[model samples]
Target chain A: MNDVITLAHGAGGRQTAELIDRVFKAHFSNPQFTGDDAAVLSIGGADLAFTTDGFIVSPPDFPGGDIGKLSICGTVNDLSCMGARPLYLSCAFVIEEGFPLAKVEKYAASMARTAAEAGVRIVAGDTKVAGKGQVDHLFITTTGIGQCLAGVHTSGTLARPGDVVIVSGDVGRHGCTILLARNQFGIDADVTSDCAPLWGTVEAMLGQTKDIHVIRDATRGGVGTVLYEIASQSHVGIHLDSQSVPVHPSVRGVCGMLGLEPLYLACEGRLVIVAPECEAPAILDVLHRQPYSQDAAVIGQVTAEQPGRVILRTEIGAETMLPPPGGELLPRIC
Target chain B: MNDVITLAHGAGGRQTAELIDRVFKAHFSNPQFTGDDAAVLSIGGADLAFTTDGFIVSPPDFPGGDIGKLSICGTVNDLSCMGARPLYLSCAFVIEEGFPLAKVEKYAASMARTAAEAGVRIVAGDTKVAGKGQVDHLFITTTGIGQCLAGVHTSGTLARPGDVVIVSGDVGRHGCTILLARNQFGIDADVTSDCAPLWGTVEAMLGQTKDIHVIRDATRGGVGTVLYEIASQSHVGIHLDSQSVPVHPSVRGVCGMLGLEPLYLACEGRLVIVAPECEAPAILDVLHRQPYSQDAAVIGQVTAEQPGRVILRTEIGAETMLPPPGGELLPRIC
Candidate 1:
């Protein structure tokens, strides 16, 4: 490990995992400590899911959502991934001293609106101010608590050999939008982030079938990284139907212009779900009826061969390995 | 309100309250929304307490503890304020890109040790890295979940006339220690922060009796601010026996040198507890027997006169009103 932390240590890839294992996991090792999206705990005779995320997006605002909206959606989606019903959330803010009060109000309004849409209550919060230049614009960390539905268990390690891998909606819009928003590449694009609270989308699929094995939101390191993690966790190979993966035209254009793989870009509102192959159509049917997952598609399947690897089958019927995610492609994209 | 945020706005005094009222409360108004240390919620057939706190104390490491230890103590104390047994916590960290990995490990170790002492599990966590100068060093936000003790309802609004106010220990060490650590004033005295997880302290009192009306950690704005807040919330007056208030000798010397009131300085591990006069001795007995609250002393009592004001009676038989806390006395003290 490097003596000093680098951006890669926060990239949500191999480096991040290594940092976690050496520092956090080393000290915070406990029975309930989680490597999953949220920690599942039995509290007060009830199964509960808890998670936390910090939002430090460079520009605080983008085409589809701002930091406040993204903060709520990020934690909500995390709980949703655990097959939990989002219930209550607490947000703590560390604002730069000179940040505008009006902008703060705007963010608060966005948070309230987003929390309401997700059917979660914003219950408690704390605010702190750092000296100007001591902090960037502002950062919001939100923690969520949810109730786990009975008999519904979803984890990255639960993927089976015959499970079909499905994505709730189009990918790469979020990462692409953030990249374009940076305006460093001199590329003009009309792409907006696919950032939305996704409890409804997850609920729709769970309502259709409880056979879902693994569910995860592709946030920091995107769908490709998520597949690698799930594959490693479940000890199964992931075989992707490359052409079947959904990507917005604008996102595709942006990725093409920049020579970036769309599959490795972040998506705030999408979920990579693994379930029995027979339940795919029914789950997709329910997802298509929901607002956030209308573009749900079966993009891959879990395979017994080549465990811990992700294979992408191209249009020419050729297969290649998707390189494992490492390094910091974009910092503060979330 | 100012057009832009100021350090005063996060001072945990009048300005912070105004910000919470104008922005947070205006947008997040709901029945379960909190004006206290933690929100009381009934979830999954059990009463629970939820709260979040952000720690950005300058000089991440201080005399008594670092940011990690303070983070756990802050959230645990918040839950303890509500008479809840803290069960779970989630921490989110936003670190500067060039922070030393060894320092991060040290903080993590402190957090683990503190959490174990508090008997709470560090269940979930997230990490994000900002650019080198984007953040001062690192900031941690911890959210806690606790089981609310049955029939043990404590709130700032529950204080009544004749309720005795007790300080769990000598006050002002934390704020004084941080002030000295900054080396701005060129005045030094040996003082350490009173930062500790106080669930055991609160539990001891509850075991003795559940009649405690209010329990609040005198943090950012100190015991003075908490007394004023309780006075306003309960619509009662507070009368202090000034000489009876416990203050460490070094802290008192520092406060005297700086012309600061020890009562208005922060104490992380101390609690300003209010309860009926009849229960004061029993509560004090329990607090005095605890490790962190050995200096527990009766500092004041709630009164019907001078509602919303705190009066201090001196040993010379003189009475003076303790100024209401406002403005920025010290920024990022906790």
Candidate 2:
């Protein structure tokens, strides 16, 4: 079997099998794999939760992470935000011709390490190769299966009047970092795109409050869009104070220079939560205790009046409706 | 809430939601899709099966199908072959900028219709737009979830001595059709690719026999590669009669003219089954009852001697080990 992958490696034959057994299984294999159609695991009467996401970030490799880590954490965080116990993942990669094996290996290794760190298994996977220029280096699709604990009911449409929307941590870090990495912008800033699995942080928050109504990973459209969605879904209004939202100085500085709005940029490691106002402090306390959640803040509050609207309180105390992003301001920044 | 998709359709905001609600959700919405972080489904009291595949076929559309149908059926067939009752699918689309809305809609509608006909629900989905040239046109990633029936356990590694190999139908039609469509060698053929979903045929076979030891879709490298995989996985020898394997005359003619081997050409709606010898004839009979399986036949038999080898009995009665195709003789045929 060839250690290096060619187009034939994904041609559904000996090379494909060997690649699966050697390169993939050798690194991510575990007992739960079962070699069956699906991983069979007992969840002690918990509800089954499944999430699937695709990573098509250009360059495949980025400053903080590559497609592999994104593939793993993207779905794992989806499960986490739903308060599920992340368990297993199925990865499917579509690589373009001429993609270097060394890069693929690096990405695969990162995925294996990330899955291990998150206490999950990459149980099964599929791979395909497309002609050159048909795909952007490589694309990864990950499907995560987890178990939702009993009494854990989360939904975007569950927020109520007088609910608090807390952003788990800093924003715009990921978007700014990727932007700088791509454009060769000479910005001397210690910023790493926040790409991480949030199951641990989610677990800590769940320990403090079961009344959390909604949880959303602010990935694509950032906190502002996520808040707007929650407000619309929950049929409520959301109010955010400019000072309360956690935005790192670097992100703000970069946004100021680039005329970019941090609220419209994507973030990986951060989550937005809407909960009863009374439970906001306790929830923030639990989140603040973790290193990943140290910068968590009470960014906003949910209100029943003027449902389906989101308002931002400016520095001068004037409020303005914050509309959803008109378009993808930054693509593939995730 | 326009029915037609715009450039801002995949922007992850009002337009994205409207597209989901107006077009996608109209066709795909089920009780499982609660507009949440993930779909909630129950797999209790049943064995769960999962499979994922990506489609990046060139031209995006072909004689009989497009990336849409391929994405749905590929994973569905994988699940179906495992004797699993596929229930839900997650669709992820990576669309290139400036892709014709009509073309994308055609693909999406095809997918939605295929899922409906296959008796499965599109429970959750994601959409992303890439810059022009980032993707050829559109690539779709689909993940399927199925429930394995009680008392039915099937695997590629289960074939044993005295088992029989059954092919559901003719081969090479898909590959030849795609070749013709590409106008390779200035050849034109009115033949349509065999791109139908195989769930119905598979369900019929499962209804007749639960003793199927192995089932594989004859794709990519085709029959030779599929049997080789089963043999290696099951550690059994497979003996095939070259003359017994059914190939449509049109496909054979195309292959002969192009110096291509029909045995290594792809087939979309086909399955290779290894069954107990006593059940082979019944399986063939059941398969042939379906229009798509009219050419179903007992192409080979499993043997213990010389395990992990696939031997072909030529028309002249001489036997030779059939090697798996080194690479895809035809690419993007699926």
Candidate 3:
């Protein structure tokens, strides 16, 4: 609705949704188009998922990973969220005129390692350079193709009452890491980004049961945003036992000092999963054995009442509605 | 290699190839990785082609096309070069914080129109915003997946001795258009960009024959760079009847005035097609009937005598080698 684009339009929130609806979806409407992480396509008897993401993180390097690692994780997680195994990736880079070639090599090395770890091939790519001041240091846009797992269907709209909600790992570490990396708040906290590829974690969960209800990555706007999205899309209420939500100690310290909600901070490697409560034990059992998801736990459940709302039960037993996810939280966190 | 990235590294010439080899290919190499327009992928029972291109053409708008249209055309043409029918496209945009929403909408509309013409669906997309002054308005990256034609095969390494080289249309218009749009040289010319979605042109040629040896779009370093690439890849020399290379009058005028070689300029809508001399008639016939290639003409022939070289026979019947392609031609000209 704004005449000019704002940072909120890229914040993965309500404004981002509106822009997609009014501009992109309005013009690019078609049968196979998807608002989910990836578009599912039936090609030559194979079900496939295709997705793309652009990374413009302010500080290219963070505590746990650089832009290259983050870029691969972002797209791989998107495919994983669709119950798809990422197979191929294409990377396109736009480098500013005077950026260091060694840094480029470093990023490429990181990407190669990440892609190998994810069992995905880097098949095609393009590179362009903009004159100095015309672009930031570097930006990467990665597109991934994946094979959708048979007998498994996961979508934000599939959440149902009585389904248990699971967090794959500690929340808000990535957002907290980025904030600290920028040093805008003059805070020194020993927080590292949760920026790992999640295909293995998702695979572990699906190995237990293919009857998962919804699976979504908490990337730009974090677990709180992901929950709000699933709740609205599935028309189910999310009731969170807020005290049970996992938060790393340093991240909790940073959030407490900054007066920020840990739930609303970004998590590059975390997943907000909803599945039948009966299957939660098996899913959690497998997740607990996984590398990136050792902190997996059931922190909430889908509710029949208060549809489209997220209610949090505090430690003192007071209940409050989680703020609807919107506005500019932080730009370029991923 | 330069310690820092230079404009030449992204100019799609020798320096660009060096960067790709020393950095990207060294790390990302795999059986499916490609140096061609698109990577040939076998999925299930169908052969597929996947490609990605980044468009950072400065000014965003030009005479005949905007960045949005150019993005679609670039990806579509890349897939078409592989004799593939482009099916699905994923677009990602990186926008500056305060770019006009209307411009974004306009570009989206242009992309929709071009994708419709190319018979491809825009299925998925992501948007990220950089802080103001951190980016040059916006950059778009489009990734396309296409079904490879059943009986056709094309590659830069497939050119053979005695094959004829053909230009799909007038050369250098896109480059000329961008040069004028920038107003770097104060020349008033009527050149419009040759930027177009060219799947139809390739389709028409394939319908006539499936034995096309190689197809390449002339962007960045233009026909000269593409020719040089093919010459070395296929270990063949190209002998050009220089006068026969088609150049629109306005474009010719601009190049003549600027002392720039039209052969080294970009053509977004043109194709540098190589095929057996015997197959030239049918390929040229169909190209002539196509909208994008109406002015298609035979420009040269491949020879085994001088491998890895390109010789030009001028109008006065003197032979000279065309300069090898390298260095910065024009930055961010798509």
Candidate 4:
């Protein structure tokens, strides 16, 4: 590992994982500490899922959602990925001193709205103001606890050969939006983040079926990175029908102009799901009817060949390997 | 309300309370949300306590403890105050890019040790690295879920006239330590932080009896602020025997030199306990036997004479009202 921290360490890519493995996981590993979006624990004769996420998005706000909205959606989606019903959330904020009170109030109100939309209550919170320049604008860390829906089970390790790979909606919009918000490339497009609370989307899909094997929100790292992680965890190959993957036109344009791969860009409101091929039809049927997943589609499938790898097929017939997720995408993009 | 945040907003004093009320409370209030150390919720037929705290202590490492240890203690102590058995904790970190990897690892080790001593599992965690110059070295936010101790109920609102007020140990060591660490005063004192996880202390005391009415840790604004909060919550008066209060000789000497009130300085390892006078002897006995609270002493008693206020009886028997907690004492003092 490198001796000093870097932007890549917070990019939610391979470097982040390496750092976590070398530092936190070395000491914090225990019976209930799973590297999944949330850890599922048996509490009071019931299964509960708990997770936490830190949001330090640069600019704090963008089209579609602000940092406060993103903070709530991020954690809620983690629980939902575990097939849990988002229940309660606790937030801790470290605000830069002299930050506008109106901005703080605006963020708080946004949090309340987002929590309500996700069917979760903001039950506890703490705020601390750091001296100006000690911290950038503001940061919010949210922790969520949810009830695991009965009879529903999902894990990254559950992907298997013959399982269908489904994405809930168009991918990479969130990343593209943040990239342009930075205006580092002197490019502007009408791209908005695909940031939204996704518990309802997951709940509505699970209502129609329970045989799903894996469900993970594609966040910090995009759908491509998530699929790579799932492949390694489940020891299966992922075969992507590249043309079937969906991407918003504006996002595609932004990525094209910047020579960025949309597949590797972040997606705040999308899910990479693996389930029995037979159940794919039903899952797609339900997802298409939901607001957030209307563009849901089967973009790939799990394969027995080339274990722990992802292969992308061209629209014509050529086959190529998708490079492993690595390096920093965009710091504080979430 | 100020147009911009001041250090006082994070001082955990009157200004902090006002900010919480005007901003957070206005939007985040819900049935399960109380302005206590932690919020109590009924989950899966079992009562639970949930809390979140952010640690942004400057000089990350103080005389007696580091940010990692302080973070764990803060949340653990919060749950302990709610009469809950600390169970699971989720931590989120925001580190400055280029921060030393060894320091991060050391802090993680400290967190592990503290969590082990508190008998809580570090079940979930997240890490983010902000660009250099955007954040001071590092900040950590920990959220905890604890199983409420059966038959034990403690709240600031439960204090009644005639209840005894107890100090678990000598106060002000933590604040004094941080203040000296800043090296602003140039007055060197052999003082160390009283930072420690107090679940075991609270557990032992509760095990002795569940008759305890209120329990609170003296953190940012110290014992004085806590007493005032409890007085306002319970609509009662606290009359202190100033001479009976225990302050470490070193801390007292430093405060005496600085014209600072020991009662207004923070103590991370102490608790301000309230209970029926009949149970004071037993509580004091248990507290004394515990390593963390060997200096436990009865410092005051609840009174009906001055509701929503704290009075101090001087050694010469002259009584004066303790000033309300206000202003920013020491920023980033944890």
* Interface DockQ per candidate: 0.88, 0.11, 0.91, 0.89
Clashing pairs in 4: none
Q: Write the per-residue lDDT of candidate 2 for residues B144-246, one digit (tens) a residue.
A: 7777666776777789999999888888777777788776578766677787778889888888988888877887767876787678778999999999999
Assess the local accuracy of residue A111 in candidate 2 as a C-alpha lDDT between 0 and 100.
85
- The CAPRI category of model 1 is high
Q: CA shift at A135, candidate 2, in angstroms?
A: 1.3
Misplaced by over 4 Å in model 3 are: none
Please give, for residues A226-314, the per-residue lDDT of candidate 4 as tens digits. 99999999999999999999999888898888899899999999999999999999999999998999999999999999999999999
The sequence of per-residue lDDT tens digits that candidate 3 reaches over residues B1-334 is 8899999999999999999999999999999999899999988777899999999998799999999999999999999999999999999999998899999999999999999999999999999988899999999999999998898878899999999999999999998999999987889999899999999999999898888899999988999999999999999999999899998899889888899999999889999999999999899999999998999999999999899999999999999999999889988899
On DockQ, the leading prediction is 3
* CA displacement after TM-score superposition, residue B5 of candidate 2 (Å): 35
lDDT digits (tens) for residues A1-334 of candidate 3? 8999999999999999999999999999999999999999988888999999999887999999999999999999999999999999999999999999999999999999999999999999999989999888999999999999999988999999999999998999999999999989999989889999899889988888999989999998899999999999999999999988999999999999999999999999999999999999999999999999999999999999999999999999999999998899989898
* Clash pairs for candidate 1: none
Q: Give the TM-score of candidate 4.
A: 0.99
Estimate, for each residue in A1-334, the C-alpha lDDT of model 2 and write its tens digit. Answer: 4332233332222333444455334432344332211233343343566677778776567678878888888888988877888876777677666666556667777887787778876655555666777778788888877777667677887898888888989997877777877766776676778888888898888887788888888887678767776777778999889888888998999888878888877888899988888998899889889867899999888887778888899989999887655444667654
**Rank by DockQ (best first):** 3, 4, 1, 2
Model with the higher TM-score, candidate 2 or 3: 3
Give the alpha carbon lDDT tens digit for every residue of A1-334 in model 1: 7899999998899989998999899988899999999999887788899999999998998999999999999999999999999999999999999999999999999999999999999999999999999999999999999999987989999999989999999999899999999999999988999999999888888888899999999999999999999999999999999999999988888888889999889999999999999999899999999998999999998999999999999989999999889989778899
Is 1 or 3 the stronger prediction by TM-score?
A: 3
DockQ-better candidate, 3 vs 4? 3
lDDT of 4 by residue, B1-334 (tens): 7899999999999899998899888998889987999999888897889999999999999999999999999999999999999999999999999999999999999999999999999999999999999999999999999999899888999999999999999989999999999999899889999999999999999999999999999999999999999999999999999999999898989999999999999888999999999999999999999989999999999999799999999999999999999988878988
Report the TM-score of chain B alone for all candidates.
Answer: 0.99, 0.85, 0.99, 0.99
